[model samples]
Target chain A: MRTIRVELGERSYPIHIGSGLLKNIGAYCQEAGFALRSPLLVVSDSTVAPLYLPQVEEALRSQGYQVVTHIFPAGEASKSLAVYEDVMTTAIQGGLDRHSAILALGGGVVGDLAGYVAATYMRGIGFMQIPTTILAHDSSVGGKVAVNHPLAKNMIGAFYQPAMVVYDLDTLLTLPPRQVSSGLAEAIKHGLITDEVFAYWCREHAEELLALDLEALGYALELGCSIKAKVVGNDERENGLRAVLNLGHTIGHAIEAVGGYGVFLHGEAIAIGMAGSALLAAKLGRDRAIYEETVSMLTALSLPIRLPEQYSEDDLMEAMKHDKKFKEGKMTFIIPEAIGSVSIVNDIDEQLVREVLAQLKKEDNPW
Target chain B: MRTIRVELGERSYPIHIGSGLLKNIGAYCQEAGFALRSPLLVVSDSTVAPLYLPQVEEALRSQGYQVVTHIFPAGEASKSLAVYEDVMTTAIQGGLDRHSAILALGGGVVGDLAGYVAATYMRGIGFMQIPTTILAHDSSVGGKVAVNHPLAKNMIGAFYQPAMVVYDLDTLLTLPPRQVSSGLAEAIKHGLITDEVFAYWCREHAEELLALDLEALGYALELGCSIKAKVVGNDERENGLRAVLNLGHTIGHAIEAVGGYGVFLHGEAIAIGMAGSALLAAKLGRDRAIYEETVSMLTALSLPIRLPEQYSEDDLMEAMKHDKKFKEGKMTFIIPEAIGSVSIVNDIDEQLVREVLAQLKKEDNPW
Candidate 1:
C-alpha cells in the first residue's frame, strides 16, 4: 500500500491506495488510534451497498465492530436535504453516538452525503472515507462535505476532515467505464494545475489511463490525492490557495446544475469547467498556446469541451453568476497559464464571458 | 461596553456586551477589519425583524454597507431543515458571496439557523452574531450553530465560530416575560457549571433579572458569555472540557424534543434539564444541597423544575437514548458536583434516571 498523509495537524489522515485494502480497514482504524467508543456506522448507498457493503461489513465485524449500515438510493439526487434528513434519521436509529465513527463506503455522492452527516451529527463525529470510485480520489481528501440545494449544488456543507481514507483499488476495478472517465477529469485537473511533467504524462498515457491499466490508474489516483492533500493541508478553510482547487468549478457547477444534476458526472462537469476557464483566460490575454493545449487535451480524452447543447449562453451565464465563487456580479476563473501553472483571474468582462461561452458552442460543428 | 475575547487562536472574536451596541455594529465591524467585502445579508425572523432589523440594517448602512434582508416566520419551527433551505436559497438570491458575512440578528433560533447557514455557505464564509435575547448569550458565544431534525433538536449543525458578537442589552427591554425567564436559564447554566458566586448572584438577583433590570441583566449576560467563551476557547469542538457545557443538555434536549418542540423555550427546557442533572448527581452521592439550590434557583427565575406533563418517562428516556451524547446505550449526564463544578458521568443506572424524571414531576402539586 502507498500511504499519503494529508499533513493537516491533528486532523491529518492517510490515503491508502492498494488492492485488497478494503478487507483490512479495521487494521488501519486501529493504527489511527480511533479508540472507537461506539459501534461503527457504515453509510453507503444502494448502488455501492450491493457490491461492497457486505465485504466491508465482514471485515469490520471481524474486527469486533458491531456495525450498522444505512443505505439510500444512489445518485446526486440523494444529496438533497430530504435525503440528508433521512440519512441522519436512519443513522440515529442505527444507534450512532458522538464517539462513533461513520465509514463512508461509496463514491463521491456517498462520501459527500455521509461525510456531511458525520460533519453535522452531534456537532461532528469521526469519519473515514472508504472510496469505491475514482472520483472520490479528489473529494475524499479535501474535507469538504455538502448536500445539494434544489437551486444550487453543494449549497449546504462543512470543512470537516475525516480520520482516514481507505482507497481500495480492488473496488475501482469494478467501476463502469463511464464512471472511470467521469472520475479521470478531476485527476487530469490536479495535473494541469500543479505539475507539468504529470500533465504531460497524463497526455501521453491518455489511452492507458482510460483503459484502466492498473499501474497508470494507481499512479494517477495517488498523485491526484497527494496534490489535494498538500493543498488542503496548507489551506484547510480555502481562505486563499485552496480557492485554486475550484479552477473550473464555477461555470462547471453552473453547467452541472443547469443540466438538472445527475446528467453530468462531477468530473465531467469539472472537465467542461476547466475548458471554459482556459478559453476565458485566453480571451483575457493569457498564453493562447496554453488555451489550445488545454482544449486539445480535454478533447483528446473525450471530455466535453462544448457547452451542453441544451443550455443557452444565457442559461449558463445565469448559473455561473450564482456560483459561490462569483463576488458582487464579478466572476473568478482559474485558468491555466502554462502546461501546469494556473492563475485566479477575477472580473472577467461579462460580455467576454458571454462571448467565450458562445464560442464554446460554436466549436461544436468542428471541421 | 464590556469586551470579552473568546480566545480561539486565530479564529477568536470579540463579544461586545452593553446597552445600545446595536446601533454601533458598523463601527465594530470596520474596526475588526471586516472592510465590508460585500453587502451585508442580515438574517432575522419575523418577530425580531420587525422589532430590530431596521435599526440593525440602518447601523450597517451607515457603515457604508448595502444590506439585503430575508425574514422567515419566527419561533422554534423556523429552525427546521425546510427553513434552513429557505435561508440558504434566499442568501444566494440576496447576493451573498464568499467575502460577504451573514449577520444573525435574533435569539438562539436565529443564531443557530443563520450561524449554520454562514457556517456551510460556500463551505463557510464570515459570520457575526447580533443576539437580541439573553439566551443567545450562551448560544452565540459557543460557536455551536445548528438546525433541528424531526427526531432531535440541534441534531444537524456545526461548531463554526463567528467574527464578532454584538450583544446589545437594550433589546432585552422589549422581550416578553416568558422570554426573559427562558433566556435566564442559560445564564444560570453557565453559573451552575462553573462559578458558585455567579450562581449565588443569579439566585439573589432573580427578580431583577426577570424584571429586565438593565444592570442585573447586563452582568448575567456578560458573565454567561465570558464563561462560554472560556470553555469554547479551551475546547472548540467539545472533545474534552467543552462536553461539560452540555451538563443538562442530554435529558433537556430529550424533554424539549419529547414535549413536541415549540412548547418549552430552549432556556426553559435547559432549566428543567439542569434540575434533572442535579438530582441525578445527588443520586450518585454528590452534595444533596446542590440539588436544593438548583431547584430553588430555577423556581425563583420562573424556570420549570417539573418535567412537562405531556411526556412519560419512557418517552423522555427514548428521546435521551437518541441523544448524540449517548454512547452504547449509556447516556452522558453532566451531573453538578457542586454549585460551581460538574462532572460528565456516562452509564448511570437507568433506574436512577427513571426515579429522577419521576421526582421532577412530584413537585407539580405542592402541599
Candidate 2:
C-alpha cells in the first residue's frame, strides 16, 4: 500500500491507495489509535451498498470491529440537511462515542456528506473514506466534504479530513461511462491547478483512461490525490492556496445548483464550469490558448463543455451569488493564469460572462 | 480597555473588557478590516434583552450600523437544537451574510448558542459578543461556545471564535446575586490552573467578589480572561493544554445532565464537580492541601460544593459516560496538581470516584 498524507498538522491523516486495502484495516486503525470496543459505522450510497458493503463489513469484522451500515440515496439529491439529520439520528441511536470512527464508502456524494456528518457529529469524530467511484479520486484527498443547501450547492459543509482514505481501484470496473467522464474533469482540474505535466498525460491518455486501463487509472488517481493532499496539507482551511484547488468548483457548483443537482454528474458540472471559467479568463486576458486546449481535452472525453439550454445566464449568476466562496457580495472566480497555474479574480465583468453563455448556447454545446 | 487575544492564527480575535467599549465598535471593526455592513443581529435572552439590548443597539447605531435584535427565552432551556434552528431562521429572514456580524449579548448560553448559529449560518459569518451577566466575563472571551443536546450539555456545538468581544463592565452592576456567584466558579478555576496568585485572590476576596466590588470584579475578569486566552492560544481545539480549561467540567456537566440542566446553575454544578475532583486529587496525593483550600474557598462563596440530593451516584456516573470530552468509554477528569497547575487524566480509578462521592455526601460540608 502507498500512503499519501493530507498534512493538516494534528488533523492530518493518510490516504491509502491500492487493491484489497480494506482487508488490511488493522494497521490503519492501529496507527490511528482507534479504541477496540468502539463500533464502526460504514456509510455508503444505494449504488455502492450492494456492490462493496459486504466485503468492507467482513474485512472490518475480521479485524475485530463491530460494524453497522447506513445506506443513503445514490445521487446529489442525497446531499441535504435532512439526510444529515437522518445520519446523525442513526449515529446517536447506535451510541457512537469520540472513539467511534465513520467509514465512508461510496462516490463523491457519500464522501462529502459523510465527512460533513463526522465533522459536526458530537463536535467532531474520526472518519475514514473507502472511495468506491472513480470521481472520489478528487473528493477523497482534499478534505473538502459538504452537503448541498437548496439555496446553494455545498453551502453547508466543513473542511474535515478523514482518518484514512482507502481507494481500491478494483471498484472502478462498475462505474458508469458518465461517471468515468465526470471523474476525468477533476483529474483535469488537478492538472489545471498545479501540474501541466499531468494535464499533458490526460490529453495523451484520455482514451486509455476511459477504457479502464488499470495502470493508467492507478497513475491518475495517485497523481490527483498526491497534488490535492499537498495543497490541503499546506492550507487546510481554504484561506489562500487551498482555494486554487477550487479552480472549476466555483462555476461548477453554480451549474449543479442552477441545473438542479443530479441532472449532470458532479464531474460533468465541473467540466462545463471549467470551460466557462476558461472563457472568463480569456476575456480577462489571462490566457486564451490554454482555455482552448483544456476545453478540447474535456470535450474529447465525452464531458459536457457548456451549459444546458434551460439554464439562463441570470440563473447561473444568481446561483453563483450564494456560493460559500462569495466575498462581500462579489462573486470570486478561480481562473487559471495558465495551465497548471491558478489565481482568484474578483474584477471579472458580468457582461463578459453573459456573452460567453450566449456563445455556448448559440453553438448548442452540451449542458 | 483590557485586551486578551485567543491566538488561533487567522481565526484569532481579541476580547476587550471595560466600560463603553460597545460605543467604539466601528473603530474596532475598521482596525480588524471587518467588512462593514448592517443591520447587525444582537442575539440576547429575555433577562439580558431588557437590561442591556437598548443601550447596545443605540451604541451600534451611533457608529452607523443599522441594528436588528433577536431575543430568546432565557436560561439553559434556550440552548437546545430547536433554539439554534430559530436563530438561523431569524438570520435567514434578516439577510445576514459574512459582512453582517452577530452580536451575542448575554450570558454563556446566549454567547454559546449564538456563536454556534454564526458558525453554521451561510456556512459561517462573523460574530461579536457583548456579555451582560457576570458569568459572561469568562464565556465571552474563550471562544468555547456551544448548545446542549438532550443527552449532554454542550454535546452539540463548535469551537468558533468571535471577531471581537466587548465586555462592558457597567452591565454587571445590575446582575442578579445568583448570577454573580455562579460566574465565580470559572474565575476560581482559572486560579487552579496556572495562576496561584489569582487563586489566592479568590480565597482572600470571596466576600468582596460576592459583594461586586468594582476593583475585585475587574481583576477577576481580566485575570480569568488572560489565563483562558493563554491556554486557548496554545491549544485551540482542546487537543491538549486546552483541556486544562475543562477542570471540574466533566462531572459538572454530569450534574447538569442528570439534574436535567435547570436544576442547578452551570457554575453551581461545577462547584460540586470541583469538590469531587478535589477529593479524588487528595486521595491520589496530588496536592492534597491545595485541593482542600480550593474547596474551602468555593464553600465560602455560598456555592453548592456537593452533589444535589436527588442525584444518586449511579446517575452521575451514567451521565459522566456521555460527556462530550469522554473518549473510549473511559472517564477523563481534570484535577488540580497544585494551586496553579492542572492535569487531564483518564487513568483514575472508578471505584475511587464512588468512594469520594460517598464521603462528600456523608459530610454534607456544603450544598
Candidate 3:
C-alpha cells in the first residue's frame, strides 16, 4: 500500500492506493479516526451499487458498523440539484449526525455528490472517499465536490476536503473498457499540465494502463494524484496554479453539456477539449513540440482527439463562453508551454480560438 | 455608523449598522475590498426589489459598476430548490465571474438564498450583504447561507461567510408590524443565550423596539450582532458552543415545518419553541426563574407562547425526533441556566418534554 497525502492545512487528507483495500476498511476507518462510529451511511449509485456495495457493506459490518447504504441512479445526469436534495434527504432519513460520518463508495458522481452532502449536512460532517473509477482518482482526492447546473457543468459546488480517500484497485477490475479509457483521459491531463515525464510515460504505457495492468495503472494514478495534490494544496480554490489542472476542462465541459450529458462520457469530452486546448496552445504556446506530443499521446490512447461532427464550431465556442471561468469576453486556457509545464493565459484571442476549433474539426483521424 | 467585526480568523467580516447606509454602497464596497470588481449582481426578492432595487442599482451604477439585478417572489416558498436553481441560472444569464461579486439586497430570504448562490457559484466568489429587514440584522451577520428542503427547513445549506454585511436601518422603516415582531424575537434570543442584561433590556424595551425606535432598534441589532459575532467567531460550525445560539431552534424548526412554512412566521414559530424550551428548563434546569422570565417576556412581546392547534404532542415529538442534533434517541437542548448563561444537555428527558408541551398548550393568553 502506498499513501499520498493531499495537503490543505487542517483540511489535509491521504489517498491510499492498493489492492483489496475495500475488504480491509476496518483498519482504514480506525486509522482515519472513525473508531466505533456506527450507522455509517455508505453511498453509491446504481451501476456501482450492485458491483461492490455488498462487499463494502459486509466489510464495514465485520468492523461492527451499522451501515446504511443508498443507491441513486448512476450517471452524470444524477449530479443535479434535485438529486443533491434527495441525497441530503437520505442523510436526514438515515439519522446521520455530526459524529456519524459518511463513507462515499463509488466513482466521481458518488464522490462529488456525497462529499458535498458531507460538506453541508448539519453545516458539515466527516466523510471518507472510496473512489471506484480512474476518473475519481482525480475528483475524489481534490475535494472539489459539487452538482452540475443545467446551463453549466459543475456550476454550483464547493471546495470541501475529505478525511481520507481509499482507492481500492480491486474495484477497478469490474469497470468496463470505456470507463477505464474515460478515467485515464483525466489522468493524462494531470500529466500534461504538471509532469512532462509522466505525460510521456502515460503514452508509453497506454496499453498496459488501459488493460488494467495492476502495477502500471496504479503507478499512473499515483503520479496523477501526486501532481494534483501539489496543485490543490497550493490553490484549493483554483485561484492561481489550480487553474492549470483544468487544462482541457473548459472546452471539455462545454461539449459535454452540448452533448447533452451522458451522450459523451466526462473523460471522453475532456479528452476532445484537450485537443482543442493543444491546438490553441500550438499557435500561442512557446513549445509547439509539447502541443504535438499531447495530440499524439491522446490519439495513441484511443481517446477522442477532435470535436465531434454534431457540434458546430459556433456551438462549441458558445458553450465555452458560458463557463464562469471565462471572464467578460476573454476565456483563460491552460496553454501547454512544455510537456510538464503550462501557462495561464487570459488574453485568448477569439479569432485564434475559432480558427483552432475549425482546424480541430477538419481533422479526419481523431479516434 | 457602527461596525461590529465578527471575527472568525481569515473569514472575519464587518456588520455595518446605521441608517441609510444602503444609499452609499460604493463606499461600503470599497471598505470590504470590492472597489473595482464590476458587473455586480444585486440579488433580491419581489417585495424588496420593488421597494429598493432601483436605488441600489443606481447607487452601484454611480460608482461605475455595471450592475445587473435579479429578483424572485417574496415569500418563504421561494426558498426552495427550484428557486435556488433559478438564481444560479440567472447568474449564468447575467455573466457573473470570479472577479464579479454578488450584493444580496433584501431580508433573510434574499440573504440566505443569494449568499448560498455566491458561496457555490464557480466554487465561491466574493459577496456582500445589503440586509433590508430587522430580521436580516441577525441572518446576514452569521454567514449561514442556505435554501429550504420541503422535508426540512435549512436541511441543505453551507456555513459560508460574506465579504461584508451592510445593515441599513432605513430599510426597516418599510417592514409591516409582524415583520418587526418577528425580527425582534431573534434579537431577544441572542440576549437570552449570551447576555442577561441584554435580555432584560429586551423585556423592558419590547414596545420601543417593536415600534422600530431608531436608537433602540439600532442598539438592539448591534448587541444582537455582537453576541452572534462572538458565538460565530468561536464556532463557525454548530458543534458545541454554537448550538447554544440555537436555544429555541430545535423544536423551533419543527413547529415551523409542522405549520406548513407560511402559516407561522420564522420568529413567531421560534417564540413558541422558546416557550417550550423555557417550560422544559423550568423542570430540568437549575435556574427556574430564567424560564419563567422568558415565557413572560415572549408573551409581553406578542409572540406565540404555545404550539398551534393543528400539531398534536405526538406530531411535535415526531418532528423533534427528525432533528439530527439529537443523537441515539437523545435530543440535545440548549437550556438557559440563567439569562446570561446556557448549557448543552444531550440526555433530554422525553416525558418531561411531553409534559412541558402539554403545559404550553394550556396557556390561553398567547397574544
Best by lDDT: 1
- Compute the lDDT of residue B161 as modeled in candidate 2: 84
Chain A fold similarity by TM-score, each prediction: 0.97, 0.95, 0.96
Evaluate residue B206 in candidate 1 and report its C-alpha lDDT on the 0 to 100 scale.
93
Fnat by candidate, in order: 0.84, 0.38, 0.73
Candidate 2 lDDT, tens digit per residue, A225-256?
99988887888766678888777777788788
Question: For model 1, how does the per-residue alpha-carbon lDDT over A191-277 read when each residue is reduced to its tens digit?
Answer: 899988887788788898878888899999999999999989999987788888897898889888888888888877888788878
Query: What lDDT does candidate 3 reach at residue A137?
Result: 93
The TM-score ranking, best first, is: 3, 1, 2
- What DockQ would candidate 3 receive versus the native complex? 0.66
- Model 1 interface DockQ: 0.74
Q: With candidate 3 superimposed using the best TM-score fit, by how many Å does residue B162's alpha carbon deviate from the native?
A: 0.6
Q: Rank the candidates by lDDT, best first.
A: 1, 3, 2
Q: Which candidate wins on DockQ?
A: 1
* Model 1 alpha-carbon drift over 4 Å, by segment: A35-37, A364-367, B35-37, B308-310, B364-367
Model 3: per-residue lDDT, tens digit, B145-224? 98887777776678889988988888999999888888889999998888889988998998898788899999999999
- Alpha carbon lDDT of each predicted model: 0.85, 0.79, 0.83
Q: Weakest 10 consecutive residues, lDDT, candidate 2 chain B? A: B358-367
**lDDT, candidate 2, residue A14?**
79
TM-scores, each model vs. reference: 0.96, 0.89, 0.96
